[model samples]
Target: MPRNDDLLDNPRSPRVRAVAKLAKRDARSETGLFLLEGPQAVSEALTYRPELVLELFATPTAIERYDTIEQLADEAGIDVEFVTEAVLSTMADTVTPQGLVAVCRQFPTSVKEIFAAADGEGPKLIAILEEVRDPGNAGTIIRAADAAGADAVIMTGRSVDLYNPKVVRATTGSLFHVPVAVGIELPAIIARCREAGVQVLAADVKGDDLLAARQGGLLDAATAWLFGNEARGLTDENLARADAAVVVPIYGHAESMNLATAASVCLYESAFAHRA
Candidate 1:
């Protein structure tokens, strides 16, 4: 149980400042901590990964507003501290704090660890992003993968940091649901997927149509999908490395699909196919 004396009322408190600094990548790296804001992300963390949470801060109104979180924290025996709204604002990255915030340790997975813990016969579907710098897109892709029941998400070196504030917020708690492997090399991931008997499919314009793949039984296989940068898509070598490069057909006049949209389409198609 949390002590009443642990209330943090000073917005400028040194401890608050340190926790707020987690918004910066270097600070998160140096301190090995990150921030999860809003009720959804915070609730998911408390439910799925309570051990990773170091502390939770909320206004009195917020605690009452989200009574479930308070109950969860109490059940898990994690302390919940009262903080002034102003103090919470200083520690939060978004304009609307949702009145509840949590400081949690980052959980990163290795490619091998992902394969080891995969369900059923093996990992059936995976989403891989290379050099994807948009934190929001990265987060959305993670959400899509989680929704589609993909085994894991791998972000290559130079991709957006999973702990970025915008990324964490955009995930809407799916970040905690999905296994994310960050900062691995593209070739290494491809090799590992191959070793694990998964077919690597790079999403590209100059490849087999996604519809054709789905209809032809290609989507039913254990698949690892690679989506590249927003502007450039995947490199030629990356495409060449894949078992097959695949494309989603567009009926609309739009030039192409957005990063996250394409990812959801591809992942869900595979998921539905596997289940069928």
Candidate 2:
């Protein structure tokens, strides 16, 4: 397919500079757009949320290698703007550019919509992050939630920005797969979950064993697993908000499990019970 516009070769052009600025939080907030790098992320946005993608840029070599990306872009009615390797590098946040970059609008699902019943279906499984500061952990949890058949994910106001480049990359395209509601407070989430007939279970160190909870049939319900900060875990006040606190028991010598790992286990347990 031939594009009418000239090849984007100038790395220092005003247009390239604007795209590169999306790497910063301020720029993303100001424009309601973020940068999507590599073929994986770009392919996902093109596949799952084509309307959100405003611009697609790829080097001729990249388009040749990832021919599927070009095809997907075409199917989504998005035109791929050809850029030089130098231009891609300038626009990409990574040290090694994957030759494909896209500018996408930040489409965050509202908390109300996440909990409300839609088309005779409401959320059955959800992952709630409270004051989680690490972008990788937050993103990985979203990815894991998607894998575990979670209905949605909620990141508290104190948590890392969901649109951060690191977080977006860590999601590995799951960001588009899952409905994520951001900037919500823990209390608001808990109240909404309860009103929606969902139980709130906190993943806390001082909580009861998860195996015991499963045996007690506690997992056999619509559940929202609340995960706290990586280092400090959940506060007493926040922990009290949940109907129960459940901990992932480590049988091995491993000191502790990462937040994302523990969350995945919890979410899968709920998913299994929901299906069973």
Candidate 3:
């Protein structure tokens, strides 16, 4: 149920302020909740993870603009209420939120749980991130992993928080489509993948040329890709832990590929190779 049926017009009201506070990491940590901003993100959440929605706020103009989202939320039994643009501005992180926002409970799953959800099948493809601190890169990687049909994604304890509002916005709700587990020990995840008979491919400039590996049919097997931080890439210790080092071959003079682009290329290559 809504806090009230009447439109919440006051931006300073306790409820509105409380919801806005979710933009902060501390608030999310304390409340175990986060905000979903813009129509794209909120609509995806409502469609894919409606049960996690706690409250839905929209302006009359926004509801009219995004009729499908409002209808879907209503169909899901979520309480949708009108709020002034002032209230929305106060609640959203972006200057323009596309006039939609929702308060959603954090989705939590452990590494073991992610594997268990695989339903007894050997893990085929997974992406493991080591201390990836950039929210945009982390979220884009999650989206790429999902698109590449990764069974799961593991983020080490030092990686960006999955629930961070910026990360959620970057994922555009692919976060909900994929099984993403955080705070797991990297070595344990690697060990589990090895036990499951999956190849561990670590992405690095020093790794074997990706194109050559693909051409040689070396990437046709089940593989888990380990990607390191944006600035540092993977450490020597990190590379030593994997079965093989992999690199995206660059034909041009570009010094390096963007983190997201590199991961996407590697994942899709594996996807294509496996399907063949």
lDDT (Cα, tens digit) per residue for candidate 1, span 1-276:
335466688988899999899999999999889999988898999899999999999988888888899999998899888888889999999987889989999998878888884345768899999988898999999999999998899999879999999999989999889899999999999999989899999888898889999989998899999999988988898889999988989998997789899889999999999999
- TM of each candidate vs. truth: 0.95, 0.96, 0.95
- The number of the candidate with the highest lDDT is 2
Candidate 3 Cα outliers beyond 4 Å, as residue runs: 1-5, 117-120
After superposing all C-alphas onto the true structure, candidate 1 shows an RMSD in angstroms of 2.0
| TM-score, cand. 3 vs. native | 0.95
Q: lDDT of model 1 at residue 194?
A: 88
Worst 10 residues of 1 by lDDT: 1-10
RMSD of each: 2.0, 1.8, 2.3
User: Ten consecutive residues with minimal summed lDDT in candidate 2?
Assistant: 1-10
Per-residue lDDT for 194-234 in model 2, tens only? 88999999999899999999999999988999999999999
Which regions of candidate 1 are displaced past 4 Å?
1-7, 117-120
* Residue clash pairs of candidate 2: none
Residue 246 lDDT in model 2?
98
The global C-alpha lDDT for each of the candidates, from Candidate 1 onward, is 0.90, 0.92, 0.88
Tens digits of lDDT, candidate 3, 1-276 = 224457788999999999989988899999999999888888888899899999988988888888898789988999787888899999988887778889999986677666663455766788999989999999999999989998888899979998888899889888889888888888898888877788889999889999889998878998999999999988899889999998998899998899989999999999999899
* Window of ten residues with lowest summed lDDT in model 3: 111-120
